[model samples]
Target: MKNKLPLYLLLFFLIIVNAFFLYNYLGAGDQGGPKDQIRPGDFLVKELGLDATQQAAFRTLGREHHRKMRGLLDDIKELKDALFKGLSDDPSHQVNVDSIVHLIGEKEAAKDLEVFRHFKKVQALCNAKQKEKFAKIIEDGLRVGGRDQGPRGARPEGERGPRSKGFEDNRPPRPNGPNANRPPPAARE
Candidate 1:
C-alpha cells in the first residue's frame, strides 16, 4: 500500500509537469502576424495612413509605375540573358557585351527615375504631418533595403585607396620581388 501511494504521487506530479509544458508550448507558439492575403498596395495604404482621395491617387500612381517598371525590368532581363549567352559562348562572341551592359544601365536608370517620380507624386498627396511620417518611412525603407549605399565595390566619395585590380579568390598574394615569376626548384628539377 505504501509503495502504491508513492507511485501514484509520482505519476500525478509527472502529469502536472507535462500539462504545464504543453500549455506553455501552445500559448507561446507564433500566431502569424498579419493575414497572408494583404497586397502591397493595401499595406502601403494602411502604413501610409492614406485617406480615400490619397488612396485613389496612390493606386493610380502604383499601377502606372508598375507597368513602366515592368517593361524596363523585362528589358533588363533580356539584356542580361544576351550578355550571359555571349559569355557562355566563345570569348569572341562577347564583343557586344559592352553595348548590352550600357543598355542595361540606361534601363535601370530610367526605372529608378520613374520610381522617384512616382514617390514624389505620392508625397504630393500627403499633408504636413503625413509628409513628415512619409519621409521617415522612406528613410526607414532605404535603410532596410540598403539602397542608400554606393555600388558594390565602389569607394565612397572623398575616400581614396588603391582599388583592387581584379577579384582575388583565396589566392596567395602576388610576390613583387625579383623571384616573382621564377619557377620553383622542384619544377626546375
Candidate 2:
C-alpha cells in the first residue's frame, strides 16, 4: 500500500503537469497569437476607417495587386534562376546575362507601377479627410528610417554613428594651418 501510494501520487503529478502544458499551449493563442497579428492591408483599412463599400473595394484591389505582384515575382525568380544557371553551363555556351538582368529589372518596374496604380485606386475610395491621412501615411512610409533619419537610416544631419574598423578615413589628416595644401618637404625635394 505504501509503494502504491507513491505510484498514485506520481501519476497525479504527471497528470497535473500535462494539464498545465496543454493549457499553456492551447490557451495562450486565444489571448495573443498569430491570429491577432495585424496584416498590412488590415492596418490600412482600420487606419483609413473604410466603410463597408470602401473595405470591399480595398480588398478586391488588394487581391488583384497581390496576384499581379506574385506573377511578376515569379517571373523575376525565373530570370534570376536562369542567370545563375548560366554559371554552371559549358563555358562556350551563350548566356546573355545582361538581357536576363534587364528583364528582371523590367519586371520589378512593373511591380512598382502596379503598386502605384493600386494605391491610386485606393485613394479614389477615400473621402477628403481620409485622403489627407492616406497621403501622410504614404509620406511617412517613404521617409528614410520611416520618419526618423536620413537616407539608408543614416544618423541625423550632424550626428555620426561609430566608424567600423578598416573603413576609417585612409587619407592623412589635413594640415589645419597655413601650409594645408602645400606638398611635404620630401615631395618638394
Candidate 3:
C-alpha cells in the first residue's frame, strides 16, 4: 500500500501538469497572441532588425506578395465554387465529385508553393537569429487549434490550418522555396 501511494501521487501530478498544458493549448494558445498580426513586413522589420527606411521598402515587398498571392486565392475560390455547384442528387455524380476533388487538390498545391515562396523571401531577409524567431512564430502559430501542431491525417499540406493563411509545416524549419538571390539588406542579420 505504501508503494502504491507513491505511484498514485506521481500519476496524479502528471495528470495535473498535462491538464494545465491541455487547457492552455486549447483555450489560450496561438490565436490569443500577437502572432495573429505578424506579417512578412513585421518579420522583416522587427525580427531581422531593419531600419525604418528599410522597413518601408520591406513593406512594399510584402504588399506585392500579398497582391500576387491574393489573385491565386481568387482562382482557388472559383474551384471551390465549381465543386459545390457540381453536387447534384443524381447517383451518377461520382465522376464529377472526383473531378472536383482533383481540381481542389491542384489549387491547394499551388497555394502551398506560394506559401513556400513567402517563407523563402522572409528567410532571405533574416540572417540566423531572425530565422530562429521566425521558426518560433511558426511553431506557435501552428498551435492555433490544439496540441496537434501537425497534420492529423493524410490531408494536403496547404489544406491544413496554416495553408489558409500560409506555412506548410511547423517544425525545425526547412529551406522552403527558392532562396531569393539578393534582397537589399536594411540592417545586419
Candidate 4:
C-alpha cells in the first residue's frame, strides 16, 4: 500500500491538470461548436465573395456572437436553477408546477431571443451577399434536423419490430456474417 501511494498521487495530479486544461478550453473558448462552424465561415468567404479584410472582420463578429451566446446560455441555466429551488418539496404535488413551467418557458424564450439578436448583430456586420449566404446555411440546417424525424428509413425499421413477421430473422447477423461455425438456424420446420 505504501509503495502504491506515489503512483496514485501522480495519477491524481495528472487528472487535475487535464481537468484544468479542459475547463479552459470548454469554458469560454470555441463556443460555436467546431470545424463545422469554420465551414460556415468558409461558406461566407466563398459564397459571399468576401475580401480578406471583410473575412477578418466577420471572424471577429462571429467570435463576439459566440461569446454572447455563451453568456445567454449561462443566464438560462441560472434561471432554471432558481425555478427549481422555488419548487415545493413534494414531487407528486402539483403546487407551483404551472408557475414553474411558465417560468421555464419564459427563460427559454429569452434565450432564443438572445440567439436571434446575436444573429442579427452579426448579420448586420456583413454585407448583403454575406447575409444571404448565412441565411441559406441556416435554412439548410433547419431542413436537415427536423424534430419529427429520427433518421432516414426509421419508420420502416420501426415497423419491423418483434411484433412483425420475420422478426427473428431480422436480428442482426452474427459479427462473422451468419456465425458460420455456430449451430445452423433451428430447422424452420
Error of 3 at 168 (Å): 40
The best candidate by TM-score is 2
TM-score for each predicted model, relative to the true structure: 0.57, 0.63, 0.50, 0.48
Stronger candidate by TM-score (1 vs 2) = 2
Model 3, residue 104: distance off in Å is: 0.9
TM-score of 2: 0.63
Q: Which stretches of model 2 miss by more than 4 angstroms?
A: 1-36, 90-95, 144-189
Compared with the true structure, model 1 gives a TM-score of: 0.57
Q: How far is 113's C-alpha from truth in model 3 (Å)? A: 1.9
- Candidate 1 ranges beyond 4 A from true positions: 1-37, 147-189
Q: Each candidate: what lDDT?
A: 0.80, 0.83, 0.70, 0.70
Candidate 2 lDDT, tens digit per residue, 1-189?
987998999999999999999989898757766757898899999999999999999999999999999999899999999999898777665548778888999999998999899899999999999999999988888884356553463334333346645544664644443455566676665
Clashes per candidate, residues 3 or more apart or on different chains: 0, 0, 0, 0
Instruction: Name the candidate, 1 or 3, with the larger lDDT value.
Output: 1
Better of 2 and 3 by TM-score: 2
Per-candidate alpha-carbon RMSD to the true structure: 13.0, 6.9, 19.1, 12.0
Where model 4 places Cα greater than 4 Å from the true spot, the runs are 1-47, 82-88, 91-97, 147-189
Taking all chains together, the TM-score of candidate 4 against the true structure is: 0.48
